[model samples]
Target: MPTQSDSTPTESARLLGRTRPAVRIAGYSAVLRTRALLTLAVLIAILCTLFALDISTGEFHIPLGRVLDVLGGGGSRAQRFVIFDSRLPRALTAVIVGAALGLAGAITQSILHNPLASPDILGITSGASCGAVLILAGTGGATTGIAATLGIPLAALAGGLLTAVAIYLLAWGRTTTGDHGVMGFRLVLIGIGVNAALLSVVSWLLTRATLTDAAHAQLWLTGSLDRSDWSTLVPAGIGLGITLLIAAASSRTLAALRFGTDTTRVLGVRIQTQQALLLGAGVIAAALATAAAGPVGFVGLAAPQIARRLLRTPGEPIVASTLIGAIAVVGADLVSRTILPVDLPVGVVTAAVGGPFMLYLLVRANRKATL
Candidate 1:
């Protein structure tokens, strides 16, 4: 090896140039990470503000200070009762449900390579709704005692899982041979068919149900947090927590999967296996959230795309999407209670926003295809 002093100017500059790109790339990576962290912090702050507003604003409005004090264990009993007993559960439910939907949407869109993909469109939400509706119809809409607390959610979870299994099985065989895993196009088409069939089942159930039962079922189907309590919240929250951990563990694979199946397989990923695992996690998240809030619409479908745009990321940013989802639901719930003449279900507000967003996505995709 030659001594450093013996090297010519050209050799030194060539060596210097070789190292510069790596240094520059590292700097860019650091900047991107910082930007992502800052985005997450801002989203979290917004989510907290929305949560407080939601908790404080209701039929008997509680001030924000009192709300914070009560949360910190320093308020009057009435304030505590109102915050902890009544408003807190509903608001907390919105946060948890929103986070879950965001995770589901992010993962689904990433794995499928489709911006338009979401739990709602893939029949997962419909399955959960069907399960809950079936229970309501069977009980003549009088879900009281244990039924109210445990029955509906359990049914919804079962329904969602069953639907996911069906979609996975139906689409798995249709995937083209190669390193590629489940084909996104096939899954979407199959999911649409399943979704249509499930909707028909729901409609038939609604029609055959008694008038009172139909009314109750319809309300639940619209997705309301009015029924949220400690009983309903605890189990769903636990499930979501577990699912979140699993999702975080699998985040690296999801990111790789977004690069396309061939690339993912080249990275030594078991494409189909990983896809199924991630899809299962996403499905569970959506189901549990739906169980808690009765199929709150479009949060899953919209949150990831919104978060991706906000962060200016190439693909959906999972953590940011989760935070945005929580914010959207909390904000929507607050709007439903305060801005509207009558309290509408939070799902109504989400659908109003998501419908147009979906159409825009469809039109954008078509334009891309035509071009």
Candidate 2:
């Protein structure tokens, strides 16, 4: 009973409505993909620039041309020594450590479903610190003849892994019924307690140790790139590779898990298994990075949060997080080296930046929850 003209216009309107969502979705998808690629490209450029600066801007002042020549295997002996002996190892260490911290932060945030739930937040870093402090203190504060350097990192890794396992076990409620927020809160409390206890132990050890040993221990606690050679780089690289592989493989599961256990389980995902694997991987990444870099605080805490804001997504931005983290740690290291005449610690720089950001996040989250 409708006129042809009216019917034709109605049909057109219906078609437009149906096609609009698809068009918008496609547009958004393209934008996200483009942004991700651009971010990665920018990060790579930044990393390369930082590496070159690290090589050329040091006290010896190696030329850019020579730095490139050394990189390409065509430089003089002095250039090779400067690039290889001084710059390459530090740069490589920064990249690996940053990548690990970023990935670990992303995984912890996603799995725990809390923006504040990073390795540092959940106590993994504190656990590692406890172990490192124990070794340094137990050796009477002397790294010179006590094999403390080798023992400390190992202890840190072990302590972090154990703490992670304990948290997971405690969070399991016969079938993983606890809310992620509750679990995260519990872990944070435990971590604080652990950290306090360890600090006390370290204080006791310092009092009993030799002055030289105490000074060495204090320096280690501050964190530095001076100890990062091929030896530290190799182990960190291996651990980072393994962590990234696990994260990539379990990404889908993590994405699903973000929507709550019931939804994830309904979609045929094994919630507990995936959670355990992700947590384990996070602990390993954090522990290795901590062992290498002396609890380089806030890289793990800040990287994923920054990635989430940049990507503007609900779930984990693994790729973005990794790149952002790499940029952050390397950038901080550059600042630490160049900004201060005396060379401040990398951990101190990260903490100084991260601590305020953390407060902002807490305030923002509180406002959102109230609304």
Backbone N/Cα/C clashes per model: 0, 2
TM-score of each: 0.89, 0.85
Deviation from native of the Cα of residue 278 in model 2, angstroms: 0.8
* 10 residues in a row with least lDDT, candidate 1: 22-31
Clashing pairs in 1: none
Which tens-of-lDDT digit does each residue in 229-266 have in candidate 1?
88778757876787788888887788798886567878
Best-performing candidate as measured by TM-score: 1
Which candidate number has the best lDDT? 1
TM-score of 1: 0.89
- What is the total number of backbone clashes in candidate 1? 0
Whole-model lDDT, candidate 2?
A: 0.76
TM-score of 2: 0.85
- Per-residue error for 160 in candidate 1, Å, reads 0.7
